[model samples]
Target: MEITFYQEVDSTNSEAKRLVDGGKAPGFAVVAKRQTAGRGRFDRVWQTPTGNLALTFAIPAPPSRPDLPTLALMTGLALHNVLQPLLGDRAQVKIKWPNDMLVNGHKVSGTLIERVGKVLYIGVGVNLVSRPENVPYETFSLAEVVNITVEELAEAVTAHWSATLAQWLETGFAPLCDDYNAHLYGRGESLRISLDRERAEWAEGTCTGVTPEGHICLADSEGHVTRYNAGDIDIIRTLQSV
Candidate 1:
């Protein structure tokens, strides 16, 4: 994989996309110490300090399950696997559905995968040193809790990603979902979900599991099942949400 490093950039996702568009081959990656206009899953701004990990890696192979958010889930699983050992066994490291990682319920990292014109860019941001304040949800940083460097974590994460990506491309989400669910944050709990984030039509259900196709499966109190396929939805944080 070819890598490009920058002291700062508007967005690694944007930079990587531009590079791939200009004929940069697959496996090209962009890394920045900081980003001026970094964005997350919903285009929410991501604030990264100099020591944080900001990267976007262009993938060579196409998605294994285009119907599922497989790339994001795989990225989260890889990160959890790598970060958990470093943080020690006592630290509670769990992965949120689609692509967010939490440390004891506070978000520490996020993943976003974008596909454009047969090319895929996996964008990831981790709060290795510091996290921005005034965010809507709780946040965490490794600097405050552990003795680790961004480079060290990056190397471990990328190695896991390479192997996981290969497995995903070879089989599909079925073979990966089991391990993925083992680290899931809100499994088998009462979940508060909003199919439409704009309004207050919140529904409560028992968080059963994720479908093979990537939709969140919820079995309501009435025994009816509900699956969310799209739109802004959040699992309302509860005392046991994580």
Candidate 2:
């Protein structure tokens, strides 16, 4: 697990890709103190304030080509593990389906996974000292609940991710399903999911939980359960819910 530090960068994920293109092997990480042009899923802007975390890990794709969604959930679980202890009884920490970590219903961390050739670039950002403004959803920072340095938090996350990924590779998502669901946000609440990028199609139902393969399961009024591999989920009747 090689780790490289940068004072500032456009994006840690982008730096990881450049390293991969230059013959750097998997199992290395790029971490930047600040990111000038970070991004999340759907190419949405991801703000990385100074003293926050902007890290990316390059991992070789498994022989079976593991599902990306499952991998993302696994990453979220990893982050949750690192943060749960720090907050310890101070506030509730939950994992939003796919790749987000929330504290008391506000987003505190996010993960973004991208496959490049035979490698997977997993990017993670955490609001340590401050949160972003002008975002659609409510956001929080670790500073609100605890005091910790970026380096300390990054080290904790990477260590937890290594253990989680190892277990996932050996047993798949099935064994971790229950644990992940235990910390899942809105596990059995009504949710509105946008079935398309344009939000033209919608599915409103009770959140049944996530499938073993990491797809979110929603049960409609008629009790028919539909598993969605990709979509944006929002809790019904909530403001700024991701």
* lDDT winner: 2
Clashing pairs in 1: none
| lDDT for each residue of candidate 1 in 1-242, tens digit (9 for 90 to 100) | 55677888889989988887788787867888888888986677889888898988888656454644666777778888888888886678988786788998888998778878777889899998898798877889887778776666666777788888888777877787888888887788777665664635766777787776667777977889998765333565553322
Candidate 1 runs further than 4 Å off: 61-65, 197-200, 231-242
- lDDT against the true structure, each candidate: 0.77, 0.89
What's the CA error at residue 203 for candidate 2, in Å?
0.4
Query: What TM-score does structure 1 among the candidates reach?
Result: 0.90
The per-residue C-alpha lDDT of model 1 at residue 72 equals 72
Q: Tens-digit lDDT track for model 2 on 1-242?
A: 77898889999999999998898889988888799999998898999979999999999988765564688989988898889999999989999888799999999988889987789899999999999999888999999889998788878888889999999988888898898999999889899888898777888889989988999999999999999988888899783456
Weakest 10 consecutive residues of candidate 2 by summed lDDT: 61-70
RMSD of each: 2.4, 1.2
- Judge candidate 1 at residue 101 and give its lDDT: 84
- Once model 1 is optimally superposed onto the true structure by TM-score, how far is the C-alpha of residue 2 displaced, in angstroms? 3.5
